[model samples]
Target: MKKSDFRYDLPTELIAQHPLAARSASRLLLLPPAPAPLEDRAVRDLPALLAPGDLLVFNDTRVIPARLFGRKATGGRVEVLVERVLDGNEARAQLGVSKPPAAGSELVLDDGTRVAVLGREGEFYRLRFESDEPLEKLLKRIGRMPLPPYMTREPDAADAERYQTVFARAPGAVAAPTAGLHFDEALLAALRARGVEFGHITLHVGAGTFQPMRAEEFKDHVMHSEWLNVGASLCERIRAAKARGGRVVAVGTTVVRALESSFRDGEVRPFAGDTRLFLFPGKRIRSVDALVTNFHLPESTLLMLVSAFAGYERVMAAYAHAVRERYRFFSYGDAMLVFPEREGGTDATAHDSRLH
Candidate 1:
């Protein structure tokens, strides 16, 4: 498939710049099984839609305050978006500046912390902090929320909490696993009470997630590697759920990648490393049965992955419906519940009035 196959027109007004008052207040668009009517429900209605024995796998990778503003040694302004923290005093980042800094040049943070540009690692520059202070501590003190490019406003204190999920534990991701942002403590408790089991995986979202697919053919696109950990215990839980005939519901695309990357020879095993898995049409989705995700950007790899999980045509129709109904879009947007509908499914073309 060509990269343009996933293209869709999205209205600027539909892009959500800020989050709702409450996490569960965002709307939920349910893309039902083919030939069934689509359902418009609030995120709070998620529990009722899931079965008792179903397992909800979530990405627990926390969003670190990765945006840093600083000046080059020549006093020119520079912006650094941390991609991965290597140690307490070193990291890899994407630098935004008029002129790229050379090795041995020092950049000064607004808070006066100094970072020496070590060298380039592909598209990112390796940086070493000049202080003994932990990188996390410096970031917490001066880094701003790494909000999506679509959000034009500057990050505020509210974004520090709103952009992150309540269950976020491991700190590493530059971007939030946005779908998880819809679940508040109350909704999680509600699902637990209804007998839904949960498992956690970590996939530190990188700044590369925002990069657009530059290749003409979809297969030619190079996926950015991200660190992930799917432990043996989680695999065991997934097996138990499968044995009991329960659905393996992935909470976000991150969770889906983490789980599916661990699948080998019909078995999902423990895996800890970087994954470059690029899901699109024709790729077999052996791990996840259902997905809970946010509306993705047009023509993005994320959109392609969702289309691969749900039929491309059906997903396009759902996007159309979402636009017409004025459901929010993007990172802080509404949620969607989609089941797999392979491309050649008989009912792929069926239209339902409920979508209107």
Candidate 2:
């Protein structure tokens, strides 16, 4: 489909800057198909909206503090945004500077750590540092959390806590599973108290999650890859949930793509690898009954994916309603609960078990 098909007016004012005082306080726009219900409710009212047997599949990928600012040996200012950590003290990153620093050049960080430019690794720069600490530990000490470009402000103390989900564990993502941001400990507890089962999977959301579609046609776009790991235990849990006729609700598009990527011959299996699965209109959804996601930028892949799930007409109409209702949009904004048409390629019964 053409990227233009997803175009809509998103006023700059509607893009949320900071999160609400309470996560669950975010508004929820629920969209079901014809004859189904569409409710404009607060996220805190989730328990009442979902069934007791529903399985909430959450992305546990942790966002890394990948933004780092430093100066070259010649005192030129530079910023290194780590795209992917290769190993201990090794990473492929975007080097922002007045000029491209060449191989064998030295980058002196503000923390006094020296990172040497090994060479170019594809579109990213390969950097090597002399440090005994592991990559994660080194990042914690010297790197800053990479906030989205929209924030208009740098990462502060509050972001270290607010930017992460309560269930975050496996570390790799440059961006957090944003939809999961709406759920706090108290809200999760409430869901569990009402018999909602939680299942965990890993899909490290790379910078790709935020990259816009420059191409008009989605088929012309080359998706950036992100690593994911779906273990057998998670598969078993989802399968069991299906057997009992429960819904598989993905917390975000990342989880949805990861779960669908794990499918084979119309069945889900344990999967661990990088996926560049392009989700647009006409793509068949193997798993994922419902989605909980943040509103996205206009004419982007995210909007297209949600449109595919929620139906193009319904999603566009719902977005118009979201703007009219004054609901916040994007990252720290509000959320949406979308139910895909179950009768076509994706049936509620087809996803009764083994959903990603």
Candidate 3:
């Protein structure tokens, strides 16, 4: 499909700058099965909307403080956003500078730490931290939260906690699974009490999650790879849920990608690797039955993925309705609950389970 197919007008004012005082206070837009009247509700109302046997597959990948500011040896200012940590003291990063540094040049951080530029790998610069400390520890000490570019402000102390989900445990992602951020401990307990089963997947969201497509034909766009680990246990639980007639709801697009990547030939299995799976129109969603996601940018891969899950026209119409209703947009924005289209449907029941 053409990238323009996903384009829609969103008032700049609707772009949320900061999260609400309470995460569960955000509004929820329900895009039920096609032809069903859409409902407007709050995030706290999710428990009542979902069935008792529903399984929510959550992305537990934790966001890392990847934004770093430093200066070159020649006194040139430079900024670094770690795309993916390579090892204990190394990473692939996007470097922003007035003048790009050559290989072998070193950046001296404001904290007095030095990072040696190894070389360029694709669009990212290969960097080696000149410290005995682990990369995660160094980042925690000096790096700032890598907030989305649209937020128009530097990270504050409050962002350190509010930007993360309560279930976040695996520490690798540069971005949080925004949908999961809406579920606080109270909401989680409520869902658990209501008998909603929970499964965990890890997809370390990279800086690439924010990259815009340069191609007009969306299929020509090469997706950026992100690390993911979907265990056997979760797959087994999902299979069990399916056998019992429960729905598998992905908490974020990342979880959907991870789960679907592990599913092949009608079997969901364990997976641990990088995936560049791009879910757009015409692609079949084999496992997930429903989705809980934040409103995405216009003409974005995220929008296309949701469009594929639901129908393209219906998803776009819902987006228009969201704009007309003055709903928030992007990360730190309100949430959306989407059910698949009925016509070009995806039925999880037909797929037999090999997740043992």
Candidate 4:
């Protein structure tokens, strides 16, 4: 499909600049399996929208403080956003500077730590830290949170906590799996009490997630790679859920990508590697039944994935309704509970069975 097919008109004011005071307080837009009316609800109502025995797969990859400011040995200022940590003291990063630094160039960070440029890797620069301390530890001391470009304000104290999900553990991501951000301890506990099962997969979101597609056609677009780990245990949990006639609900697009990447031979398998899986209209999503995700950017790959899972026209209409209702957009925004499109008309029986 053409990239323009996914475009939508969103007001500048609708892009969420800050997170809501409470995680579970954000609004939820329910897009039932098409040919139905979109319902406006709150994040707290998530437990009720799901049925017992459902498996909610979450991306537990934690966001790291990846943004850093430094100066070249020649005294030119440069900004660094670490894309991925390669080792204890080495990382691949995107540099913002007046001119691209040559290989072997040295940079002095604001904190006085030095980093040596190893070389370039596509759009990223590989650098090795001169400090005896690990790169991750150094980032904890001086790096700032990497907020989305849409937010004009600098990262503050609240962002340190609010930008991360409560269940975040494995730290590597420069961006959060935002759909997981809506669940607090209370809501998780509520879901557990309602007999829902939980599973986790790790997909460290890269800064490339925000990169715009320059290609007009989807076939010409090359997706950025992200590392993911889908364990055998989680695969078994998904199978058990399916066996029990329960839905496999993905918490975010990241989780959806991970699960789908791990799917092989009609079942999910253990996988630990980088994936460049791109989901767009016409691709069958066999790994997940329902999805919980935040509003995405216009003409973005994320939006195309949503349009693929639900019907393209239906998703566009729902997005229009969200705009009319003034639903918040992007990272720190509201969410949606979306079910996959069925072969026939709407699966009202399955929809009603879960909600009622």
Candidate 5:
């Protein structure tokens, strides 16, 4: 299919520039599997919508302040968005300049730290910073938040407080698991009180997510690899939950990708490595029975993922409904709870075929 098929006219006025006063206060659009219809609710009502034995899988990959503004040794302006922390003083980053920085070139950061381009790894460049502190400690003190492009503003004090999920722990991701942003401490407590079980996984989101689809055929579009890990303990929990006839609810598209990528044979197995798995229409989902996520950009990979979870027609209808009801869109906007519509025969296309 052509990329144009995914394009929709998203009004600029509906884009949310800032977060709501309360995280869980956002509206929720519920789209059940096919043979059923769509339902609209509030995020605060999540506890009542879920069953006691369902497995709620969350991405605990925390967002780090990865954006660094600096100038090259030649006095040229440069911006670096750290993709991953490889080692103590080494990391991979996307350096923005007229030409990519060559090896051995030095750039001065906003905090007066200097980083020398050490090497190149595919689309990303390796940089070795002059610091004795661990990458996390250095970034927390020096780096600015890597807010999404639509914000049109620099990361400030508020972003430090609002951009991360309440359960963030393993710090590595460059971007936030935005759908998880809606769950506050109280909301999580309510879910726990209802006996909803929780498990954790990690998938450090890459810069590819923010990249717009430039190809016509969706299959031609490629995704960058991101490191992920699904532990054995989590696998045991998921199997137990499934055996008990409970649904596996993925908190975001990242969790869905990680879980589905790790599945082997008839059971979900633990996996540790990089995955470039991409989900779109006609793909079969072996994992993630339900999804909780924010509305995504038109013609973006994230939109395709949601469309894959719910049928394309259902997603389009829900988006139309959201717009008519004046629901917010994107990172700082409202969320959707979509249950996969696979009640009919499976689609002919395997999940990997749509990855391209």
Candidate 6:
């Protein structure tokens, strides 16, 4: 499919700048399997929308304070966004400055800590901290929250809490799994009381998630790689849920990607590695029966994934309805509950071939 196929018209004012006061207060748009009417509801209504035996899979990767400000030894100012921590004192990062620094260039942080540019890997630079302290500890002291570029204002103290999900524990992600952000401790307790089962996968969201698709055709695009771990325990839980006629509901796109990446010949197996899975129209998604995700940017890969899960026409129509209803868009925005698309007025069956 062409990249233009996923484009939509969104007003600038609709971009959400701040999170709602209450996490569960955000609106939820329900897109059931095709032919079912869409329902307008709130995040708090999620427990009622689901059944007793349903499984809700979540990405437990936590967001880190990965943005840092520093100066090149040449005296030029530079901003660094750590993409992934490689070791206790080394990381791969993207640098923003007037000019790209050569390999081996030294950078000085505001706190007088120094970092050495070891080398380059594609679009990221390998950086080694010169401190005896681990890089993670240094970030905690001076690094700022890495907010999405679409958010105009600077990250404030409130963002330290609001930008992270309540259940976040495994730390590594530079970006939050926004869909999971809607659930608070109270909401989670409510789901548990309703007999909903919870499963977790860790997919450390990379900064590359925000990169734009530079290719016109979807076939030519190369998806970004993100590290994920799908445990054997979660796979067994998913199988048990399916046996009981319960749905596997993914909390966010990250969960969907991780689960799908672990799926093998009619089974989900344990996996621990990097994945470059890309989902678009025509791909059969066998991992989850329903998806809970935030509104994505127009013409983005994320939008295309949701369109593939739901029908393309249906998703576009829903986006139009959301725009007309003044729904907020982007990272700090509202969410949708989407089910798989049926073909020829019947349920679509999974194909044998794996999708990349």
**Model 2 off-target regions past 4 Å?**
35-37, 342-344, 349-356
Better of 4 and 5 by lDDT: 4
Give lDDT tens digits, candidate 1, residues 121-159. 878999998887899998888888999999999988799
Tens-digit lDDT track for model 3 on 43-75? 898888777788999999999999999899999
| Alpha-carbon deviation at 149 in model 2, angstroms | 0.6
Model 1 spans with C-alpha error above 4 angstroms = 342-356
142, model 3: CA deviation in Å?
0.5
What is the model-wide C-alpha lDDT for candidate 6?
A: 0.89
lDDT of each: 0.88, 0.84, 0.89, 0.91, 0.84, 0.89
The window of 10 residues in a row where model 5 has the poorest summed lDDT is 347-356
Winner of 1 and 6 under TM-score: 6
In the range 1-356, model 2's lDDT, one tens digit per residue, is: 58887888878899888888898999999776444556788888777767778899999989999889899998999998888888657988888899888999999989888999999955678998767778778888888888888888888888998898888998888888899999999999998987889998899888767777778877689888889998899899888877887888899998888988998877678999999888877887768878899998888788888877767888898999999999999889999887776554455654323221
Candidate 4 off by > 4 Å: 343-349
Model 3: worst 10 consecutive residues (lDDT sum): 347-356
Candidate that beats the other on lDDT, 1 or 2, i.e. the better one: 1
TM-score, one value per model: 0.94, 0.94, 0.96, 0.97, 0.93, 0.95
Instruction: Please provide, for model 6 over 216-328, each residue's C-alpha lDDT reduced to its tens digit, 9 standing for 90 to 100.
Output: 98889989999999998999999898887677889999998998899898768999999999988888788888889999998898998898889799999999999999888
Candidate 1 collision pairs: none
| Candidate 6 colliding pairs | none
Query: What lDDT would candidate 5 get against the real structure?
Result: 0.84
Ranked by TM-score, the better of candidates 1 and 4 is 4
Q: Top model by TM-score, which number? A: 4
Tens-digit lDDT track of model 5 for 1-356: 56777777778888888999999999998776565566778999888878778789999988999988889988889999999888768998988887777888899987788898988887789999888778778888878889888877777788887998989998888898998999999999998998799999998987767887888886787787899999999999998987776778899999988988998886789999999888888877777778899988888888888888787878888888888888899989999988766653222122222111
Best by lDDT: 4
User: Model 1, poorest ten-residue lDDT window?
Assistant: 346-355
